[model samples]
Target: MYLNSTSPTPESCEAVYPDLASAIRCVREQWCELHGYTEPFCRNGVWWVFPPNGVIPVCIRDVMNSDKGQWVRIGRVSVAILPDGSFAIAPKSTSDRTD
Candidate 1:
């Protein structure tokens, strides 16, 4: 479910994952399809995509700083869209931490 002027949601939208790992797997698969590259995974509780041309980080920082709720958990994993039109995955619990 894209909130506004953004990219399309990943495939398997209705199929729910039982855990964060499964959710990340689904996100990664979808991201790979969209970007034509291997998807990056969460590192140290944060997922980030560094574009080759120096794009801003596409982490949840954008949405988290927006009008949306300070913390959002999609299914079981925390998510963010990078500036390069990539996706970031984080632990659902980290949404509470100060940005």
Candidate 2:
């Protein structure tokens, strides 16, 4: 979500959702609108969208959560948007380290 009046990458930031399905829907809708894509599919640990009439799927965002909060990938870093709207750099998982 928008961090404040001056924050850049506002559209690329994360927001809270009530459940996993809602979070996935939010990402799919936003990514499709911004990039003119139609379909969303997940492979590996990343979520991707198909370009209109194109073959390759583009990685748009990753939606995840833990006991801490909701996590999303922003550029090269994964960040947690806590329930209170604070931010934190999420600790890397084993899968992240290999990537």
Candidate 3:
């Protein structure tokens, strides 16, 4: 599967995956790298958070039914599961922007 990201430079955002397992692994690795963490505390196998301390529970809207990818904020991080099955991760700034 060719999982792509939404950005001006699509070529740089694109990734190839031979299988779903490998794709999931890549997502986890990329997310960890983005946060500069050797390991991150993942919640419910979907949401990931760092530090692993005093994390208040937050409700996140289900994005499974959306045809297009939807960015959902979970505390300090934002997560989006794309239609092509790629996961997008970004830190939520104070301005509440995903970019």
TM-score list, all predictions: 0.33, 0.39, 0.34
Arrange candidates, best lDDT first. 2, 1, 3
Q: List candidate 2 segments past 4 Å from native.
A: 1-16, 61-99
Residue 29 error for model 1, in Å? Answer: 2.4
Residue 61 C-alpha lDDT in model 1: 32
State the lDDT of candidate 2 residue by residue for 43-69, as single tens digits. 775666677788977665432232243
Candidate 3's error at 33, in angstroms?
0.8
Query: RMSD in Å for candidate 2, one decimal?
Result: 11.1
Tally clashing residue pairs in candidate 1. 2
Q: Residues 1-99, candidate 1, lDDT per residue (tens digit)?
A: 323344334432445556655554554445444544343545566665543344554543332332321122457544454322344454457768887
lDDT measured at residue 55 in model 2 versus the true structure, 0 to 100:
90
How high is the lDDT of residue 98 in model 2?
A: 53
User: Alpha carbon lDDT of residue 89, candidate 2?
Assistant: 54
Instruction: Give the backbone clash total of model 3.
Output: 0
Error of 2 at 21 (Å): 4.3
Against the hidden true structure, what lDDT does model 3 obtain? 0.41
Off by over 4 Å in 1: 1-12, 50-99
